[model samples]
Target: MVDLQVQYQQLKGEIDRALAAVLDTSHYILGPQGQAFEAEAAAYLGVKHAVAVASGTDALHLALRAAGLGPGDEVITSPFTFIATAEAIAYVGATPVFVDIDPQTFNIDPELARKAITARTRAILPVHLFGQPADLAPLQAMCDEHGLLLIEDCAQSFGATYAGRQTGSWGALGCFSFFPSKNLGCYGDGGMVVTGDDRLAEQLRMLRNHGSKVRYHHDIIGYNSRLDEMQAAILNVKLRHIDRFNQLRRQNAHYYSERLADAGVVPPREDGKGVHVYHQYTLLTDRREAVQQALTTAGCASAIYYPIPLHRQNVFAAAFGGVSLPVSESVAARCLSLPIFPELNQEQMDRVVAAVRGA
Candidate 1:
């Protein structure tokens, strides 16, 4: 949907220079560029430490492993998310307990999360779906009451904020993706884990690199997951303009909201304290399939953030045991994402609105 051609054209020179520098150094993995990017990312997110990894899935996996979560441990998370959120839990041999989402924000319903917690509940992994921040106050309160860690699946939210703070900093650990489709994406797979606690950050670092604080001396069983120097270099270049790009996305979202406000579609609702980046401008309507197809036929790209809820997914259903959540199922069927990016203009937005309403 996004014209990445335009994006690269604008930032081509800087990006090429960054890549050339990394290649000339002959250091491709976990080199100077990765370290510099990590520092900048941590500072931007206002967190103490940031660990770069291979992908958001690895970020979630390591975040959970670093916290000492393993088999038999139950993690409370919303079922209305991409499979990766629950898949990470399953990868760590942890139980993926399903929770419903708030009808408005489509984030984990804290009440449902609290209800899902038990002696086995080790963490609450809330996915910030479609770039909206989850309600943190209630989630934090529940986690505190139950002594559970909070890991935010921030794959969709990079610039989004909750209560004036970034989305990734609210929980114990925030896992972010740098997939090409994301707000601050790299050329290929990249991810980072941000944490306020120094000890936890240390654990995460060790986990990402063969569980060794010192080279070649293993402290615990870990995996091989590192942010390649090339991807890190590219991300650093993109980081400079991320704020402006997100602002443009916000303006485009406003245009769509104004035009489609009365198109029998429910637009996203932002929290008073949350600065939504509009990574994906999604809407709810009974005619989601028709609307999406109509937009595509009309030359406006459209997609569904997730067509299947996690609870119903065969993998999660087999691993997490049984659960019945109505809200999540409904959202999976109705929510649709339109072409939303920093480069999209008012004219394109008007056409998308027209297609949807016309459908």
Candidate 2:
């Protein structure tokens, strides 16, 4: 759904120079480029530390491990999200408790998350789905009252804000993905873990490496999940333009919302508590298949973010089978993501709107 070639061409000079510098240095792993990118990302997010990793999934796994979560621990999260949200918790040997989402915002419902808590509930992992931040004030208050950790899955919310503060600055740990399609994407796979705590930051850095603070002196078991220097360099160039890109995305989303006001489709909601970056301008329609087919026939691309909720996945069905989550299930079956990228123009957007109206 993204035109990476066009984006690259727009930032050609800076990206080419950055890659050339990395090549000249020949330092591929956790080198100066990665370190500089981490500092820039930390400053942008207003967090004390940002630990770069190989993938977003790795970032979530290391964050959970640093928080001392393991077997017997439970993490409450929404079912209407990318599988990696739950996979990270499962990777850390923690049980993922599925909660329903708010139908309007399509985010984890705070009340449902609170009700799902138990003695074993150690953390509340919330995803900022489709670039809209979850209602974090209540979730943060609940975490404080229960002595639970709060983790934000910010894979699609790179430039979003809530309550006048950046999204990744909330919670104990905020995980981000730099997949090429994200708002602040790099050339390839990359991710980061942001935190305000120094101790947790240290643990995350060591864990991303082979648990060796000092060379060859392993302190604990860890994983090899370091961000590549080249990708970091590319991200550094892209980061400089992320705000402008997100603003364009917001404009495209507004056009879509205005056009589809009474077209029997539900556009994404902006709750006034946060600014949406429009990672995906998703629409909800009962006739999802027909709408998508129309878009395809009209040369417009569309996709479903998640057709199956986490609770119904075959891998987790044995444990969460027969669970009834009306909102998440219904939303998953009807949600359709439209072509939303900074490169899209008015002509493209009009075509998509006309196709939807025709459908």
Candidate 3:
């Protein structure tokens, strides 16, 4: 379905040298490599500060904590994302307010979000699900009108832009993940929290540490979520090629779209402001189970972004008061993520389309 080995071999020497440099430095935790990566990432996102963290999940937690989310606070967000989005909110003892998704973009529905806000709502965490940026304008306005924070869960759309700005920069705090399979994946687990407010940025830096900017002097309760220097080194190498890699993924997506035209599937959303990085060229179809079976039989692979909506999950069932989100439930049942990556060749893409068409 996809391949990362080609990239490893293509940049083997650089990676080897980078890894060796990490071993030589002996300053493994939040070392120079991590600092260098932070600057690079901040520049890439056009933000003032980028705090590297342990993983994408940690990025969310740090962002929430920095924004002052805690027990009794409510964060309105869609239920159609990876569990991490809700988990981050719950980590701080906050309630994850459930909302439905926009039928077209598979992102949080702004109208639903507007309806869900209340006095308890302290933040609105809109996810850029499946590489598509959520509509931010209205959501931002809602936050402004109600004095709520905006956090973007950009785990999939690391390089995606919205309305002339990076996806992560649109909100108060933009969180990212560099898991092994993301569009800008590292060698292992890594994450970052990007923000423009200098005060919030400073808080994130301190929070990732033990709530203290200086050593051995804790200011408040915090967690150890620092990014690994070695992983940062590896990501630095990959960051240099992410734009080119995204370009290839875009090209492959076009090929897949053209081939799947007759397969009775609604393609991923591609609109004016943002570019779908093909994080997963997902399609909407009722024949999800049959499609998966056929793709597997045809020597291909596929997946579902989520099989259950967050509101229905056991952890949140008792928190969200049995929220009814029809759109989220429907999308979860029908959506299928196809094999997509920069290295996916035309032949493989053709096989994927044919498998879906045949199914």
Query: Taking the tens digit of each residue's C-alpha lDDT, what string does model 2 give over 143-209?
Result: 9999999999999899899998899898999999999999998878999999999999999999999
TM-score of each: 0.96, 0.99, 0.97
Backbone clash pairs for candidate 3 read none
RMSD in Å for all candidates: 1.4, 0.7, 1.3
Candidate 1 TM-score to native = 0.96
Highest lDDT model number:
2
Please, what are the lDDT tens digits per residue for candidate 1 over residues 1-359?
A: 67888899999999999999998999998899999999999999999899999998899989988888899898888888778888888888988888888888888888888877788889998888888888888898888888889899999899889888998998999999999889999988999999989899989888889888899999988888999999999999999999998899888888888888898999877767588888898889999878988898889998887788877877655654466678878888899989989987778878888898899
- Candidate 1 achieves a global lDDT of 0.88
lDDT for 5 in candidate 1 is 82
lDDT of each: 0.88, 0.94, 0.88
Residue 57 local lDDT, model 3: 99
